[model samples]
Target: MVQRRYSGRMDERFEIFLACAPGLETTLVGEAKAAGFGPLRPDAGGVAFDGGWPDVWRANLVLRGAARVLARIGGFPAVHLAQLDKRARKFPWGEVLRPDQGVRVEAISRKSRIYHGGAARERVERAISETLGAPVSDDGVRLLVRIEENLVSFSVDTSGEPLHRRGHKEEVGKAPMRETLAAMFLRECGYTGEEPVIDPMCGSGTFVLEAAEIAMGLLPGRTRRFDFERLASFDAAAWEAMKRGAARRETGLLFRGYDRDAGAVRMAGANAQRAGVDGTAVFACQPVSALERPEGEPGLVIVNPPWGARIGKPGPLHALHRSLGDVLKERFRGWRVGLVTPEAGLARATGLPFLPPGPPVAHGSLKIRLYRTNPL
Candidate 1:
């Protein structure tokens, strides 16, 4: 695994944006910085950093919180459809796109003279086909076109699938928390992989497995493929070396998860095994009331419980929250808690002293928030 040094030249560098759930921008920024990403700039929905192609690969391969990584290829002012088509044709698609591979162009316009999204998309698609001789398909590499105030920018979705699909965790429970979101929430709770984590309502053991992997220094995208692999600029040898050179450490602490459903426990255990964290992650089937603190120092107890958005009714959920709060207070003293839900009232039902929560994050159609409590 030879370390190929990249001369950070201006021509070789480009702007890369790591998209995340809206409210978790700060947490994602911290994770990105820790992963040696950049001098970062945090925005509404993501964090921006400057790097070359290798940085793009590292981001997709190692970032635990980003939903997708987008590379800003080029931008110019296009007031009308003809100008957009001309500029798009002149853009260097061959540098990033292969002739045999297909592409899907998506366009969005806001406060711009060329305001028709469909027309913009059509022009971009035609330009790509005419200029690069590439076929267009729905499942091809995604190219995004943003025409805002007559300025058009082109970006390619480097991450084909969402980062949450880590090429493992085949089984999922109802309304399961995405692995990306789980990782960000863990970071928001001040988790640094030095303490044990418990997800009492662990649906498919996302939090527990992610914690174990972090503690062991496993790469999130180790088993996954990216859209960059299809690009013309992809370097197979360098990428193989990067993957082979990922550092893996050992931890004595065990991350634990509990679910009332026997099937969920089995699924979680299987997912952990596939993630190569089975030795450090433990999953069991048991009700929350039966949860007892493991023998060790106090750690974090995080749960993404049913929020009544798609699951149970609000009344029973209130009781469930109350019971969870009671159990934690009575038995799990000195342990911190991080609870995620959509309703403030439901979070209040827990009766745990929570600090001011961050902004609401868009998850599907619903907005969720994280409520953190000091050590009890």
Candidate 2:
């Protein structure tokens, strides 16, 4: 059975999936709730909510922890390739895709009768191409097909580029932390934008810049284009009005980032300027040993130091972590701390009074955990 609900306006209600790193689903759900998006349900890799196209647009524009937004168009049971072809051709592709535009089909199969992903993709591709008269290209809107228990569901990736791009920060350091992960980690540390943030190892200034933007109430996708704009249901005028209506807040607190490499310091500064947050984000070249507590109400210190796998041998990294622990204990009294690392041993090596570790989050190929400390 196909379920449908019309919103009685230009926008129709549909299911939206906000994709995130695996362990961050709960945090993303909190963000969604704070953004006034619900009723929400948490899933394995993302959060699911029911909304119209406008909700989809708002989610893509404002969600800081989501990697992408997927709109679930519709689905049906199809036990075989031929049935999938028939059902896919009958789908209302014209409702979302323009005839002149191109689309790419991707398929995943799990415990299904039609278990071949390639065959499933090919059939769906042919159906859409023949029925909708649209060209299939590699760089166009992506349509994802999932087959499980003989049921096929279709979703469109409405976010063209990953939300982490944020349409700024052209220059990045080696092994830089993603903006999405950085935002979630900040949230995990109980940061609410009222307090300042410091990143002693601020690689591309992701954490500092993200914290500054949060304080300013800036939309993450304010300057970026999304794949949803290419869909047939996109309303340019409404989107423009929505963008103009964003309420930006003003803040006086400063976020700080320091790196031992002068080049990294310069890069972070430049990236902050491009992000329109240089006023609130200060970058300097210094090692953790020289880290000084900024003058303010005590705030949070968040850092994503290099794991031994990326930067150096484990022995040196342990020494570095110990040194960092010493610096924070000695200087940053009453400040909270969040440290991200791939190894628990390295985290333990820090000797900071971290509360129990959080679940590991997948970043690239490594599983990293955030170890946090209360005010010290």
Model 1 residue pairs with clashes: 334-376
- Name the regions of candidate 1 deviating beyond 4 angstroms: 1-11
Output the lDDT of residue 32, model 2: 97
Which digits, one per residue and each the tens of the lDDT, describe model 2 over residues 46-92? 99999889999999999999999999988888889989888888888
By TM-score, the best candidate is 2
- Write down the lDDT that model 2 would get: 0.92
- Clash statistics: count for each candidate: 1, 1
Question: Residue 338 of model 1: what lDDT?
Answer: 97
Worst ten in a row by lDDT for model 2: 2-11
Q: Give the distance in Å from residue 286's predicted Cα in candidate 1 to where it truly belongs.
A: 0.9
